[model samples]
Target: MIAIDNVLISDEVVEEQFVCDLTKCKGGCCEDGDAGAPLLKQELDHLNNYYEVIKPYMTPQGIRENEKQGRYVYDRHFGWVTPTIEGQICTYAFRDAQNVIKCGIEQAYLDGKLPWKKPISCHMFPIKMSQSEVDPSMEYLNYEPREDLCSAACKLGKKLKVPAYVFLKDAIIRHYGEEFYATLDATAQHLKEQKG
Candidate 1:
């Protein structure tokens, strides 16, 4: 049996007890828009450098999109990311020789080259950062954990055992900042209360 903990969800937010069915979901977040996620200056530089190194391997359309954007910007809900190819599901995702869906930069990062990291928006999904109009504070809201609706390709064979909130808080702080995280936490708590 596959060990549930081996599934790679967000390190800071996903807990061991959580299980998702990614097959049915179609990576909704990735297909939702063209703007992608926002990026910090340092992150943008890292991504550009990664792009340069991987230029030879990227599709022509990918190169064109990168050249057009020039820099990454936070597109509200999502952060900075490469623009998607026409009719393609994800800009950074592609199938390898064995036909496995893979992320080019993620593979590079795993290989020890520091590719630009994924934006928080793409990194954290289902769980969202929502802000109250009456208050500047934001909240972290998790869409109910539904394994049945996840994409088959992305699903693990076993259950996960980690707490979602812990992973989320760590990620928020890492990508945004402590202040932003605090606000998000407050927002999440408020939303939870409202739901209850």
Candidate 2:
């Protein structure tokens, strides 16, 4: 494990390889999970604030689901999560020309309609962070290797020699800041040397 700033990072982040193969997975992560996309407090606020623009890009069913669930929903099992269409695909997701699920929130951000990118949690694929049991102010950054959706990604990343922390640099930086990510990079290099 690596400790930087207030985050405790798992070594698997440096050891594991992963790169999302969207073509094969077809954004399965957006649809396969039992629950909707998890949301932070600020994300819930942003969803409400940006609903006017975001609504146009969303599917009719997605819009209706959002209306029925009220932007976001709180569940005992999942805590606060983005509303889903009958608890299937995330309400913020839409199909592209290839019929692959895509995030409407991210599309809006890419189009310069919204200032923030999609949720940090969404951006940081395969990495889940939780408050540290030792210290609540700090966080535990762990690698969670999901099957089906991420297996191809893992193989692809291994073929290309990209580690999880390196593959997810931008998202890690976004969530934890540049200094934290720099430490992760350093940790990766050290691990590589140790293996050699």
Candidate 3:
């Protein structure tokens, strides 16, 4: 079991012992068109390198599509494009001779050529990071309750037997600071006691 943000998780969750066939159900979060997640400077730099390396492999139409949508633009004032549409799948996300999705970045990391890097947003899926204004509280945005594509994600989470708090805690720590974690814990406890 791993302890993150002071939340305990069973080893089963880490091993993905829970069956979550994201590929089978929703083709993973990237399928939807959400300019991909916001990236930290370091992650963006890494992605830019990967993008350059793989640019030649991408289909012409794919390049045109990405440019047409201006997919890289992010507005700090407006938040991300809502009802995110799935942009072009990555050029590296293709089947190898074994017919498996091959990621160049992951391979590069293994080869010691590049550090393991991925957009935080991409890393965390089905679980979302949201900030509340009234309370300045960090909350989990459970895609399960939403209609459209996220419903599929929700169903997948259920099949995986993913506990809501486990996923939620991870997201909080990833997006917010560790200090916010205890706040979330306290809030949950207070709500539970109120219910009881």
Candidate 4:
């Protein structure tokens, strides 16, 4: 594990290879999960505050589900999460012309209807985060590539020589910061050199 400020990152984040192959997975991470996408406190607020603006991008069924169960539901395990449609796709997800599932909230952001994009939890996929048991203020970022949905991505990453941390650069930088990402990249390079 690597300790950087308040975050503890798993070594696998720099060792394991991963790059999402959306054409193959078709956003299975959003649809096949037992629970909906997890949300941060601010993300929950975004859903509540901008639902009217984002509603047009969502499916009718998704809107209905959100209406039935509040904008964001409290999960016993995940705290706050976006509601799923009948335990299937997320209430904020929509199918594109290619039949690929996409995030409606992100669509709204792309259209300039909303300022924030989708939840950070969703943006940072394969790298799951949780508060450290020993220290609540600390967070852990672990690389957890799903075989069912990410096999192609894993293979592609290996082919491209991209580690999980490198593949998730934008998300990591967004969630953490540019300095955090720079430190991680440097640490990863140093570790590689030591092993060699």
TM, every model: 0.53, 0.95, 0.51, 0.97
Q: Which candidate number has the best lDDT?
A: 4
TM-score order, best first, reads: 4, 2, 1, 3
lDDT preference between candidates 3 and 4, better one: 4
- What's the true lDDT of residue 167 in model 4? 83
Sort the candidates on lDDT, descending order.
Answer: 4, 2, 1, 3
Please give, for residues 4-113, the per-residue lDDT of candidate 3 as tens digits.
44343333333231223545444444444434455555664565566655445444654555466543545464254311224445433434454434444455555666
Candidate 1 residue runs with Cα over 4 Å from true position: 1-17, 20-29, 32-35, 38-42, 54-57, 69-81, 130-141, 144-196
User: After superposition on all CA atoms, how large is the RMSD of candidate 1?
Assistant: 9.0
111: Cα error in model 1, Å: 1.6
Q: Model 2: residues >4 Å from true position, as ranges? A: none
**Clashes (N, CA, C under 3 Å) per candidate:** 31, 0, 4, 0
lDDT tens digits, residue span 97-121, model 2: 9988999988998899998788777
**What clash pairs does model 4 have?**
none
What does the lDDT come to for candidate 3?
0.47
User: Residue 69 in model 1: shift from native, Å?
Assistant: 4.4
Candidate 1 lDDT trough over 10 residues, lowest sum: 1-10
Residues 39-95 of candidate 4 have per-residue lDDT tens digits of 898887888899999999999999999889989998899888999998989998999
Name the top TM-score candidate.
4
Worst 10 residues of 3 by lDDT: 11-20
